[model samples]
Target: MKKSILLFTTMFCLSLVVFAQQNKEQDESSDTVKTIEKLKYKQQPGLALAASKIFFSDKRYSISGFGEFNFIPVQNNVNPEMGDLELYYSSLYRYATFFGYRLTDKLIWNSEFQIEFLHYKTEESHYEIVIEAFFDYLFKDYLKARVGFYPLTIGYVNNNDEPVMFYSVNRSEVERLIIPSTWIEFGTMFYGNLSPSWSYALGFSQGLNSQKYISGTWIRQGREIRFDLPKSISINPQLNYTGVKNLTLSTSGYYGNSGQGEFIEISGEPVEVKGKINLTSAYAKYDWKNFRFVTVGTYGQLGDTEKLFELTKDENGENGQVLGKEVYGYLMEVGVDILPYLRKGRPIHEKQNFLFDTHEMKLSLFSRFERLNTHNKIEQSLEGLPRVESDMEIWTVGLNFNSRENIVFKANYQHRLNKFNGDQFPRKNIVETGIGFIF
Candidate 1:
């Protein structure tokens, strides 16, 4: 451990030296206003370099972050028979910072730290987390190696989670429930470009633990991302194509055993039950003039659910907590930026690669529809319970405005629908507003 610490310190110091040298070069270039080309960002990893330009104009290593808060001023359950009405919720939800360094032309370090739900009443505190901390070595244009804790590169949000990247006050429900966006793991990965417009990644990591699997949320509770060593091993692979103008197509998958390093008591005796998860997703995104469209479809299957459900029924003593054999999700969205058509606006000036314009504004009107079911299939029937606790369909209409790329203000109306004909559960309607900034 001591040797590891010393090596890290030395590399960090050397990175500072590289930054100083780059700054000197920038000073000598044309500098009424520094553009991206003046300071060398191409030496960093691909996505990290893009995000850095949005977070900082010139300071890449200094602390920079994005924070967003939301408010729900109106909420109601269309039917009163479900239960007592919920007041909805609000908070200073997410504050995340980037600490990235370019150690050398062939190496880089990237990390993100975050705070969630910043609210207190003298007895409660928020949650702190390390979203990602990893190192990458660039050996060639088509291949690179990475190790450390990294988020699974399964979807767009999991890869580019900055607030400015999405128009919703919150992220997509499909991404949250089905894909479990921001899912991180400790592992080694190899990723790189196949061509100027194609990229791919393949990695193996610590897998989920079926011991924690619950009914309504499927494998979400089984992530084992906290203080536990999951014994199972998992692999995720992805391929993406961006050859068409303003269009992107991608496919990704995850396969892993969901059981490891744990035991469950069944019939007053200890037994080891095994399970595994198989998931796949397809995505297509397009832009035509000022209009944007996106759609995604995902399906997943779990093996050995009968044994897992019996264990869940014993531990939780609730049929609603039964295990699921399958889960799936679907999503579609369309939006248009009306600002450019309303008037002629100055595009943010760039020098080949710099993404900065302090005052350029954007306004978009968008709508999204999602349908998901965690318990789409089960091996055994619950003797007494609601059909499924996690069956849900949601749609929302919203308007998002950006004073600049780094600052956003938004308002939206959302309505949720469930199965069971009409009102076995509540159909909730809500109005919300939000503000987010990056610095």
Candidate 2:
């Protein structure tokens, strides 16, 4: 079944590409529509697109953002040794607001601050935090530059992580683990569209803190946020193609040194290691006839792990963990707007008007599968590292109800299987529901 699904996805993608080129003129014209809901950023992510109204209207300043709330009824969760307890039953995941302004026709400034608690830890009280603040200087659709803090576009969620943008109540596991969405850094980016068919982004930003590396998550634990950006830098680059109607394909890459001036004791000697990270990913999304298909594949490499693992060692160096030299994962899902199939009236595709222009409610069903191994390949398993691969596999089935263009309610059941000790261990399950909205 997995093989069949993979084959179908491949064929589906090829078919879309061929059809898009065959009818390029129609798809190309769709780019010029600067409707209040569909203004063009050419090179910005969905968060930027969220301000379409501000960009299209005569107003010079506006406020916008998104909020997500969720409730989880049951979750067996990770293994006991992993020491992860389930968050409480319910919580307001995030309340972020975006502040946008048009400095001039040629320049734009956008900023964002969010109030959020880590899972159900609202008792700790998170302060209002600045998630993003940037100045965009647009010379044309073909050339642009941005300065200050921003996030990368290495994967779908990294670009469009709003609650309503995806079918699942939580972000996909593969994206969260391997690609790590909401991964932001203080940086400078140059981006623009070569044409209506092609867009690209290049960013140089603060690097990670290598000392924080750990097993099971690789470099995901190394991300940091600070008022003073570090000197070590990471570079991220992306290229996108949207020549097909309702179809987008992109490939993005990241490479950087994660040392951040931290020194670790390797062999009883202090050493400043340039623990580098290299990652690349390919993503695709297509919507047609009330059906949407999404897929992403990512591969990554970590440098100086042997020494970095030395940093992760306990004071006695007895139970130190392992970090993989390489890691990879992929995810795939399809969603169908079943409301159209269930209706007694006209078929959505046959309607004379644009399918997306409709304000009617929609009910959708979706299922997704993901496989990842943060410790996929490593030399002789020593300490806590496994001799055989330690990997995770997940399956999720969900429903989404869109009552309006920007509001969504969703629920999903997720099951997890983890492989280690030459055995497959069932890692509980997660059942959750949530609501998401944008303004």
In terms of lDDT, which candidate is strongest?
A: 2
Which ranges of candidate 1 are over 4 A from the true structure? 1-62, 74-89, 118-128, 224-229, 267-269, 310-320, 344-359, 386-388, 420-427
Clash pairs detected, candidate 2: none
Per-model TM against the reference: 0.78, 0.80
- Give candidate 2's whole-model lDDT: 0.69
**Backbone clashes counted, model 1:** 0
- The residue-level lDDT of candidate 2 at 202 comes to 91
List candidate 2 segments past 4 Å from native.
1-48, 51-53, 74-92, 120-130, 313-321, 346-358, 379-390, 422-427
